[model samples]
Target: MKLLLVEDDRSVATAVSAILTQHGFEVVHARTGGAALQALLSNGVDSFDVILLDVGLPDHDGYEVCGKIRRRTETPVIMVTARSDVRSRIHGLNRGADDYVVKPYNTGELIARIHAVSRRNVPPSGGEVRHESELQFGGVRIELTARRVSVAGTAVHLTRKEFDLLALLAQRPGIVFRREQIISEVWESRWDGAERTLEVHVASLRSKLRASALIEVVRGVGYRLRAPSA
Candidate 1:
Protein backbone atom coordinates (compact mmCIF):
# COMPACT_ATOMS: atom_id res chain seq x y z
CA MET A 1 0.00 0.00 0.00
CA LYS A 2 1.13 3.58 -0.67
CA LEU A 3 1.62 5.71 2.45
CA LEU A 4 2.37 9.39 2.98
CA LEU A 5 4.94 9.95 5.73
CA VAL A 6 5.10 13.52 7.05
CA GLU A 7 8.19 13.76 9.18
CA ASP A 8 10.94 16.38 9.33
CA ASP A 9 13.61 14.54 11.28
CA ARG A 10 15.85 12.98 8.68
CA SER A 11 17.27 10.19 10.81
CA VAL A 12 13.90 9.27 12.23
CA ALA A 13 12.35 9.49 8.79
CA THR A 14 15.03 7.18 7.38
CA ALA A 15 14.47 4.62 10.09
CA VAL A 16 10.66 4.68 9.70
CA SER A 17 10.89 4.54 5.92
CA ALA A 18 13.13 1.50 6.03
CA ILE A 19 10.81 -0.23 8.45
CA LEU A 20 7.67 0.50 6.44
CA THR A 21 9.34 -0.42 3.17
CA GLN A 22 10.47 -3.69 4.66
CA HIS A 23 6.84 -4.37 5.47
CA GLY A 24 5.76 -4.01 1.80
CA PHE A 25 4.58 -0.43 1.85
CA GLU A 26 5.60 2.18 -0.72
CA VAL A 27 6.19 5.32 1.30
CA VAL A 28 6.14 8.86 -0.06
CA HIS A 29 8.28 10.92 2.27
CA ALA A 30 7.66 14.61 3.02
CA ARG A 31 9.89 16.81 5.18
CA THR A 32 7.49 19.67 5.70
CA GLY A 33 3.81 19.99 6.39
CA GLY A 34 3.33 22.07 3.24
CA ALA A 35 4.98 19.41 1.12
CA ALA A 36 2.89 16.74 2.76
CA LEU A 37 -0.31 18.64 1.97
CA GLN A 38 0.86 19.22 -1.58
CA ALA A 39 1.57 15.55 -2.11
CA LEU A 40 -1.78 14.54 -0.65
CA LEU A 41 -3.76 17.01 -2.77
CA SER A 42 -1.78 16.29 -5.92
CA ASN A 43 -2.07 12.55 -5.67
CA GLY A 44 -5.24 10.93 -6.92
CA VAL A 45 -7.41 8.44 -5.05
CA ASP A 46 -5.07 5.46 -5.39
CA SER A 47 -1.95 7.37 -4.40
CA PHE A 48 -2.09 6.81 -0.66
CA ASP A 49 -3.84 4.30 1.53
CA VAL A 50 -2.84 5.92 4.84
CA ILE A 51 -0.88 8.80 6.34
CA LEU A 52 1.72 8.49 9.11
CA LEU A 53 1.89 12.05 10.44
CA ASP A 54 4.49 13.38 12.84
CA VAL A 55 2.94 15.67 15.40
CA GLY A 56 5.99 17.89 15.61
CA LEU A 57 6.40 19.13 12.06
CA PRO A 58 9.05 21.71 11.19
CA ASP A 59 6.65 23.85 9.17
CA HIS A 60 3.37 23.37 11.06
CA ASP A 61 1.71 21.60 13.93
CA GLY A 62 0.44 18.16 12.96
CA TYR A 63 -2.93 18.88 14.56
CA GLU A 64 -3.53 21.84 12.25
CA VAL A 65 -2.65 19.79 9.21
CA CYS A 66 -4.86 17.03 10.50
CA GLY A 67 -7.79 19.42 10.91
CA LYS A 68 -7.35 20.68 7.34
CA ILE A 69 -7.16 17.21 5.88
CA ARG A 70 -10.18 16.10 7.88
CA ARG A 71 -12.18 18.91 6.29
CA ARG A 72 -11.31 17.66 2.81
CA THR A 73 -10.94 13.91 3.04
CA GLU A 74 -11.73 10.81 5.02
CA THR A 75 -8.25 9.35 4.73
CA PRO A 76 -7.00 7.75 7.92
CA VAL A 77 -4.38 9.78 9.81
CA ILE A 78 -2.23 7.98 12.36
CA MET A 79 -0.46 10.49 14.58
CA VAL A 80 3.14 9.82 15.60
CA THR A 81 4.37 11.92 18.49
CA ALA A 82 6.71 11.93 21.49
CA ARG A 83 3.87 13.04 23.68
CA SER A 84 2.64 10.05 25.63
CA ASP A 85 0.21 11.86 27.84
CA VAL A 86 -3.47 11.12 27.62
CA ARG A 87 -4.16 14.80 26.92
CA SER A 88 -1.99 14.69 23.83
CA ARG A 89 -3.67 11.56 22.56
CA ILE A 90 -7.04 13.11 23.24
CA HIS A 91 -6.00 16.23 21.34
CA GLY A 92 -4.96 14.23 18.29
CA LEU A 93 -8.21 12.30 18.24
CA ASN A 94 -10.16 15.54 18.63
CA ARG A 95 -8.39 16.91 15.55
CA GLY A 96 -9.66 13.95 13.48
CA ALA A 97 -6.74 11.55 13.60
CA ASP A 98 -7.83 7.93 13.42
CA ASP A 99 -5.10 6.64 15.72
CA TYR A 100 -2.16 7.82 17.88
CA VAL A 101 1.34 6.44 18.42
CA VAL A 102 4.09 7.87 20.54
CA LYS A 103 7.59 8.45 19.22
CA PRO A 104 10.03 5.57 19.57
CA TYR A 105 7.03 3.37 18.88
CA ASN A 106 7.32 -0.32 18.24
CA THR A 107 7.07 -1.10 14.53
CA GLY A 108 4.79 -4.02 15.22
CA GLU A 109 2.47 -1.91 17.34
CA LEU A 110 2.42 0.78 14.69
CA ILE A 111 1.50 -1.76 12.06
CA ALA A 112 -1.30 -3.05 14.24
CA ARG A 113 -2.70 0.43 14.73
CA ILE A 114 -2.54 1.03 11.00
CA HIS A 115 -4.48 -2.11 10.30
CA ALA A 116 -7.04 -1.33 12.98
CA VAL A 117 -7.65 2.18 11.64
CA SER A 118 -7.90 0.91 8.09
CA ARG A 119 -10.49 -1.64 9.11
CA ARG A 120 -12.53 1.02 10.87
CA ASN A 121 -12.47 3.39 7.90
CA VAL A 122 -13.59 0.69 5.50
CA PRO A 123 -17.09 1.73 4.42
CA PRO A 124 -19.91 -0.52 5.48
CA SER A 125 -21.43 -2.59 2.69
CA GLY A 126 -24.88 -2.20 1.10
CA GLY A 127 -27.60 -1.32 3.59
CA GLU A 128 -27.05 0.45 6.91
CA VAL A 129 -26.94 -0.87 10.47
CA ARG A 130 -30.23 -0.58 12.27
CA HIS A 131 -29.27 -0.62 15.91
CA GLU A 132 -30.34 0.60 19.30
CA SER A 133 -30.72 4.30 19.93
CA GLU A 134 -28.24 4.68 22.76
CA LEU A 135 -26.81 3.26 26.00
CA GLN A 136 -27.81 5.17 29.09
CA PHE A 137 -26.71 4.76 32.69
CA GLY A 138 -25.82 7.01 35.61
CA GLY A 139 -26.57 10.16 33.62
CA VAL A 140 -24.22 9.07 30.86
CA ARG A 141 -25.41 8.43 27.33
CA ILE A 142 -23.63 6.88 24.40
CA GLU A 143 -24.97 7.66 20.94
CA LEU A 144 -24.14 4.66 18.81
CA THR A 145 -24.63 6.31 15.41
CA ALA A 146 -22.80 9.54 16.28
CA ARG A 147 -20.12 7.64 18.17
CA ARG A 148 -20.29 10.15 20.97
CA VAL A 149 -20.65 10.08 24.73
CA SER A 150 -22.23 12.59 27.06
CA VAL A 151 -22.24 12.68 30.84
CA ALA A 152 -24.99 14.50 32.62
CA GLY A 153 -25.93 16.47 29.53
CA THR A 154 -22.25 17.45 29.02
CA ALA A 155 -20.06 15.91 26.40
CA VAL A 156 -17.14 13.84 27.64
CA HIS A 157 -14.49 13.32 25.01
CA LEU A 158 -13.28 9.76 24.53
CA THR A 159 -10.87 8.11 22.16
CA ARG A 160 -12.18 5.55 19.69
CA LYS A 161 -10.75 2.67 21.66
CA GLU A 162 -12.11 4.08 24.87
CA PHE A 163 -15.59 4.22 23.39
CA ASP A 164 -15.33 0.67 22.13
CA LEU A 165 -14.17 -0.62 25.49
CA LEU A 166 -16.94 1.25 27.24
CA ALA A 167 -19.53 -0.07 24.84
CA LEU A 168 -18.34 -3.64 25.28
CA LEU A 169 -18.48 -3.35 29.05
CA ALA A 170 -21.80 -1.57 28.95
CA GLN A 171 -23.35 -4.25 26.82
CA ARG A 172 -22.71 -6.89 29.41
CA PRO A 173 -23.03 -4.71 32.51
CA GLY A 174 -21.81 -6.86 35.36
CA ILE A 175 -20.22 -9.46 33.12
CA VAL A 176 -16.43 -9.40 33.30
CA PHE A 177 -14.40 -9.22 30.09
CA ARG A 178 -10.90 -10.60 30.09
CA ARG A 179 -8.15 -8.23 28.97
CA GLU A 180 -7.61 -10.34 25.89
CA GLN A 181 -11.25 -10.04 25.04
CA ILE A 182 -11.15 -6.28 25.56
CA ILE A 183 -8.12 -6.03 23.30
CA SER A 184 -9.79 -8.03 20.58
CA GLU A 185 -12.93 -5.92 20.67
CA VAL A 186 -11.24 -2.54 20.96
CA TRP A 187 -7.91 -2.86 19.14
CA GLU A 188 -9.25 -5.47 16.75
CA SER A 189 -6.30 -7.60 17.70
CA ARG A 190 -5.34 -10.41 20.03
CA TRP A 191 -3.59 -10.20 23.39
CA ASP A 192 -0.20 -8.49 23.45
CA GLY A 193 2.00 -7.16 26.26
CA ALA A 194 -0.10 -8.90 28.91
CA GLU A 195 -2.93 -6.45 28.22
CA ARG A 196 -1.27 -3.18 29.15
CA THR A 197 -3.37 -1.48 26.50
CA LEU A 198 -6.54 -2.58 28.25
CA GLU A 199 -5.29 -1.31 31.57
CA VAL A 200 -4.22 2.05 30.16
CA HIS A 201 -7.55 2.49 28.38
CA VAL A 202 -9.44 1.69 31.56
CA ALA A 203 -7.47 4.31 33.42
CA SER A 204 -8.31 6.86 30.76
CA LEU A 205 -11.98 5.97 30.92
CA ARG A 206 -11.99 6.34 34.69
CA SER A 207 -10.50 9.79 34.30
CA LYS A 208 -13.15 10.83 31.84
CA LEU A 209 -15.96 9.64 34.02
CA ARG A 210 -14.57 11.58 36.98
CA ALA A 211 -17.41 12.17 39.45
CA SER A 212 -20.08 10.16 37.68
CA ALA A 213 -18.68 6.71 38.34
CA LEU A 214 -19.14 3.28 36.79
CA ILE A 215 -16.84 0.59 35.36
CA GLU A 216 -15.09 -1.55 37.93
CA VAL A 217 -11.89 -3.51 37.67
CA VAL A 218 -11.85 -6.99 39.17
CA ARG A 219 -8.45 -7.57 40.69
CA GLY A 220 -6.37 -10.20 38.91
CA VAL A 221 -9.29 -10.84 36.61
CA GLY A 222 -10.81 -8.25 34.25
CA TYR A 223 -13.18 -5.29 34.15
CA ARG A 224 -16.92 -4.91 34.29
CA LEU A 225 -19.43 -2.07 33.94
CA ARG A 226 -21.16 -1.63 37.29
CA ALA A 227 -22.90 1.42 38.56
CA PRO A 228 -20.71 3.06 41.15
CA SER A 229 -23.80 4.29 42.91
CA ALA A 230 -24.86 0.69 43.37
Candidate 2:
Protein backbone atom coordinates (compact mmCIF):
# COMPACT_ATOMS: atom_id res chain seq x y z
CA MET A 1 0.00 0.00 0.00
CA LYS A 2 1.12 3.53 -0.73
CA LEU A 3 1.28 5.95 2.24
CA LEU A 4 1.97 9.65 2.58
CA LEU A 5 3.98 10.67 5.62
CA VAL A 6 3.74 14.37 6.52
CA GLU A 7 6.17 15.70 9.09
CA ASP A 8 8.39 18.77 9.23
CA ASP A 9 11.17 17.06 11.12
CA ARG A 10 13.63 15.59 8.68
CA SER A 11 15.12 12.93 10.94
CA VAL A 12 11.78 11.65 12.10
CA ALA A 13 10.45 11.68 8.58
CA THR A 14 13.37 9.66 7.24
CA ALA A 15 13.18 7.16 10.06
CA VAL A 16 9.47 6.64 9.76
CA SER A 17 9.60 6.50 5.97
CA ALA A 18 12.32 3.85 6.14
CA ILE A 19 10.34 1.84 8.67
CA LEU A 20 7.18 1.95 6.60
CA THR A 21 9.09 1.04 3.47
CA GLN A 22 10.61 -1.93 5.27
CA HIS A 23 7.08 -3.00 6.09
CA GLY A 24 6.29 -3.02 2.31
CA PHE A 25 4.32 0.24 2.12
CA GLU A 26 5.42 2.72 -0.53
CA VAL A 27 6.16 5.92 1.40
CA VAL A 28 6.03 9.50 0.13
CA HIS A 29 7.59 11.87 2.65
CA ALA A 30 6.32 15.47 2.92
CA ARG A 31 8.21 17.87 5.17
CA THR A 32 5.77 20.76 5.38
CA GLY A 33 2.01 21.10 5.52
CA GLY A 34 1.97 23.18 2.32
CA ALA A 35 4.14 20.67 0.54
CA ALA A 36 1.96 17.89 1.83
CA LEU A 37 -1.10 19.61 0.41
CA GLN A 38 0.65 20.10 -2.87
CA ALA A 39 1.72 16.45 -2.97
CA LEU A 40 -1.85 15.34 -2.39
CA LEU A 41 -3.28 17.67 -5.01
CA SER A 42 -0.61 16.56 -7.43
CA ASN A 43 -0.73 12.77 -6.97
CA GLY A 44 -0.58 11.49 -3.41
CA VAL A 45 -4.25 11.95 -2.55
CA ASP A 46 -5.45 9.79 -5.41
CA SER A 47 -2.67 7.24 -5.11
CA PHE A 48 -2.04 6.78 -1.42
CA ASP A 49 -3.93 4.28 0.70
CA VAL A 50 -3.26 6.11 3.98
CA ILE A 51 -1.88 9.44 5.20
CA LEU A 52 0.24 9.74 8.33
CA LEU A 53 0.07 13.37 9.43
CA ASP A 54 1.99 15.26 12.08
CA VAL A 55 -0.05 17.52 14.31
CA GLY A 56 2.64 20.20 14.72
CA LEU A 57 4.03 21.11 11.34
CA PRO A 58 6.32 24.03 10.52
CA ASP A 59 4.06 25.55 7.86
CA HIS A 60 0.58 24.61 9.11
CA ASP A 61 -0.96 22.39 11.73
CA GLY A 62 -2.09 18.85 10.93
CA TYR A 63 -5.68 19.72 11.86
CA GLU A 64 -5.89 22.26 9.03
CA VAL A 65 -4.13 19.91 6.63
CA CYS A 66 -6.47 17.06 7.57
CA GLY A 67 -9.54 19.26 7.10
CA LYS A 68 -8.35 20.40 3.69
CA ILE A 69 -7.57 16.86 2.56
CA ARG A 70 -10.90 15.54 3.85
CA ARG A 71 -12.68 18.13 1.74
CA ARG A 72 -11.15 16.44 -1.28
CA THR A 73 -11.13 12.74 -0.41
CA GLU A 74 -12.33 10.21 2.12
CA THR A 75 -8.88 8.60 2.33
CA PRO A 76 -8.00 7.31 5.78
CA VAL A 77 -5.93 9.69 7.94
CA ILE A 78 -3.91 8.85 11.05
CA MET A 79 -2.67 11.80 13.07
CA VAL A 80 0.79 11.40 14.58
CA THR A 81 1.56 13.57 17.58
CA ALA A 82 3.78 13.71 20.59
CA ARG A 83 0.89 15.08 22.60
CA SER A 84 -0.96 12.56 24.74
CA ASP A 85 -3.74 14.66 26.18
CA VAL A 86 -7.33 13.54 25.74
CA ARG A 87 -8.26 16.96 24.42
CA SER A 88 -5.69 16.72 21.66
CA ARG A 89 -6.90 13.27 20.64
CA ILE A 90 -10.49 14.50 20.64
CA HIS A 91 -9.48 17.55 18.61
CA GLY A 92 -7.70 15.44 16.00
CA LEU A 93 -10.64 13.04 15.79
CA ASN A 94 -13.14 15.89 15.51
CA ARG A 95 -11.05 17.38 12.72
CA GLY A 96 -11.64 14.18 10.71
CA ALA A 97 -8.61 11.95 11.32
CA ASP A 98 -9.59 8.29 11.33
CA ASP A 99 -7.17 7.59 14.18
CA TYR A 100 -4.55 9.33 16.35
CA VAL A 101 -1.15 7.96 17.41
CA VAL A 102 1.12 9.65 19.87
CA LYS A 103 4.65 10.28 18.65
CA PRO A 104 7.38 7.98 20.05
CA TYR A 105 4.76 5.30 19.52
CA ASN A 106 5.74 1.77 18.65
CA THR A 107 5.96 1.24 14.93
CA GLY A 108 4.16 -2.11 15.15
CA GLU A 109 1.29 -0.50 17.05
CA LEU A 110 1.11 2.33 14.55
CA ILE A 111 0.99 -0.15 11.71
CA ALA A 112 -1.79 -2.02 13.48
CA ARG A 113 -3.80 1.17 13.85
CA ILE A 114 -3.24 2.02 10.22
CA HIS A 115 -4.41 -1.42 9.14
CA ALA A 116 -7.48 -1.24 11.36
CA VAL A 117 -8.52 2.18 10.05
CA SER A 118 -7.88 1.11 6.48
CA ARG A 119 -9.96 -2.01 6.94
CA ARG A 120 -12.84 0.01 8.37
CA ASN A 121 -12.78 2.45 5.45
CA VAL A 122 -12.80 -0.25 2.83
CA PRO A 123 -16.08 -1.45 1.32
CA PRO A 124 -16.96 -4.95 2.45
CA SER A 125 -16.15 -7.74 0.03
CA GLY A 126 -18.75 -10.21 -1.25
CA GLY A 127 -22.42 -10.79 -1.00
CA GLU A 128 -25.81 -9.58 0.00
CA VAL A 129 -27.06 -9.43 3.56
CA ARG A 130 -29.94 -7.91 5.49
CA HIS A 131 -29.21 -4.22 5.43
CA GLU A 132 -31.30 -1.39 6.81
CA SER A 133 -31.09 2.10 5.45
CA GLU A 134 -32.59 3.73 8.49
CA LEU A 135 -33.11 2.85 12.17
CA GLN A 136 -35.66 4.69 14.27
CA PHE A 137 -36.36 4.79 17.98
CA GLY A 138 -37.79 7.33 20.35
CA GLY A 139 -38.37 9.88 17.57
CA VAL A 140 -34.74 9.53 16.52
CA ARG A 141 -33.74 8.25 13.13
CA ILE A 142 -30.25 7.15 12.17
CA GLU A 143 -29.26 6.82 8.53
CA LEU A 144 -26.68 4.04 8.47
CA THR A 145 -25.23 4.59 5.04
CA ALA A 146 -24.87 8.36 5.56
CA ARG A 147 -23.68 7.92 9.16
CA ARG A 148 -26.11 10.57 10.28
CA VAL A 149 -28.64 11.02 13.05
CA SER A 150 -31.84 13.01 13.33
CA VAL A 151 -33.94 13.56 16.41
CA ALA A 152 -37.40 14.62 15.20
CA GLY A 153 -35.76 15.51 11.86
CA THR A 154 -33.09 17.70 13.44
CA ALA A 155 -29.53 16.70 12.56
CA VAL A 156 -26.81 15.65 14.98
CA HIS A 157 -23.14 14.67 14.58
CA LEU A 158 -21.99 11.45 16.15
CA THR A 159 -18.38 10.40 16.39
CA ARG A 160 -17.57 7.25 14.41
CA LYS A 161 -17.50 5.04 17.51
CA GLU A 162 -20.66 6.61 18.90
CA PHE A 163 -22.44 6.07 15.61
CA ASP A 164 -21.28 2.45 15.39
CA LEU A 165 -22.32 1.68 18.98
CA LEU A 166 -25.66 3.39 18.54
CA ALA A 167 -26.28 1.58 15.30
CA LEU A 168 -25.48 -1.78 16.89
CA LEU A 169 -27.82 -1.05 19.78
CA ALA A 170 -30.57 0.23 17.50
CA GLN A 171 -30.36 -3.02 15.54
CA ARG A 172 -31.46 -4.99 18.58
CA PRO A 173 -33.22 -2.79 21.06
CA GLY A 174 -33.90 -4.27 24.54
CA ILE A 175 -31.21 -6.92 24.04
CA VAL A 176 -28.45 -6.47 26.61
CA PHE A 177 -24.86 -6.63 25.37
CA ARG A 178 -21.77 -7.36 27.36
CA ARG A 179 -18.98 -4.83 26.89
CA GLU A 180 -16.83 -7.51 25.29
CA GLN A 181 -19.58 -8.42 22.85
CA ILE A 182 -20.11 -4.81 21.85
CA ILE A 183 -16.37 -4.27 21.46
CA SER A 184 -15.96 -7.34 19.29
CA GLU A 185 -18.93 -6.33 17.18
CA VAL A 186 -17.75 -2.79 16.52
CA TRP A 187 -13.97 -3.22 16.44
CA GLU A 188 -12.10 -5.56 14.18
CA SER A 189 -10.89 -8.91 15.52
CA ARG A 190 -7.28 -7.74 15.80
CA TRP A 191 -8.10 -5.26 18.52
CA ASP A 192 -7.21 -6.25 22.08
CA GLY A 193 -10.33 -7.18 24.04
CA ALA A 194 -10.25 -4.07 26.15
CA GLU A 195 -13.38 -3.44 28.15
CA ARG A 196 -12.25 0.09 29.14
CA THR A 197 -12.21 1.08 25.50
CA LEU A 198 -15.76 -0.17 25.13
CA GLU A 199 -16.79 1.83 28.20
CA VAL A 200 -15.33 5.03 26.77
CA HIS A 201 -17.10 4.47 23.47
CA VAL A 202 -20.39 3.80 25.21
CA ALA A 203 -19.99 6.94 27.29
CA SER A 204 -19.51 8.93 24.11
CA LEU A 205 -22.61 7.31 22.63
CA ARG A 206 -24.66 8.24 25.67
CA SER A 207 -23.45 11.82 25.47
CA LYS A 208 -24.50 12.15 21.83
CA LEU A 209 -27.76 10.24 22.34
CA ARG A 210 -28.63 12.56 25.21
CA ALA A 211 -31.99 13.71 23.88
CA SER A 212 -33.53 10.24 24.02
CA ALA A 213 -31.97 8.56 27.07
CA LEU A 214 -32.01 5.46 24.90
CA ILE A 215 -29.00 3.65 26.36
CA GLU A 216 -29.52 2.05 29.72
CA VAL A 217 -26.62 1.00 31.93
CA VAL A 218 -27.26 -2.43 33.43
CA ARG A 219 -24.76 -2.23 36.30
CA GLY A 220 -22.67 -5.40 36.28
CA VAL A 221 -24.65 -6.92 33.42
CA GLY A 222 -23.60 -4.46 30.70
CA TYR A 223 -25.90 -2.11 28.73
CA ARG A 224 -29.22 -2.21 26.91
CA LEU A 225 -30.66 0.02 24.23
CA ARG A 226 -33.95 1.12 25.69
CA ALA A 227 -36.30 3.22 23.67
CA PRO A 228 -37.83 6.25 25.31
CA SER A 229 -41.22 4.52 25.29
CA ALA A 230 -39.73 1.64 27.24
Model 2: per-residue lDDT, tens digit, 63-135?
Answer: 9999998887787899999999999999999989999999689876686576567656642222111147987
Sequence-dependent TM-score of model 2: 0.54
Considering only N, C-alpha and C atoms within 3 Å, which residue pairs clash in candidate 1?
A: 81-103
Tell me the deviation in Å of residue 71 in model 2. Answer: 0.7
Give the residue spans of candidate 1 off by over 4 A: 123-230
What TM-score does candidate 1 get on C-alpha atoms?
0.54
In model 2, the runs with Cα more than 4 Å from the true position are: 123-230
- Per-candidate TM-score against the hidden true structure: 0.54, 0.54
Worst 10 residues of 2 by lDDT: 122-131
Return the number of clashes found in candidate 1. 1
The sequence of per-residue lDDT tens digits that candidate 1 reaches over residues 1-230 is 56789999999889989876655457899998899888877885335667899999988999999898777778789999999999999999999999999878877667657645755664223211113568777788878779899988999999988898887777545545556657777787878674777778888888897733487766655677876666
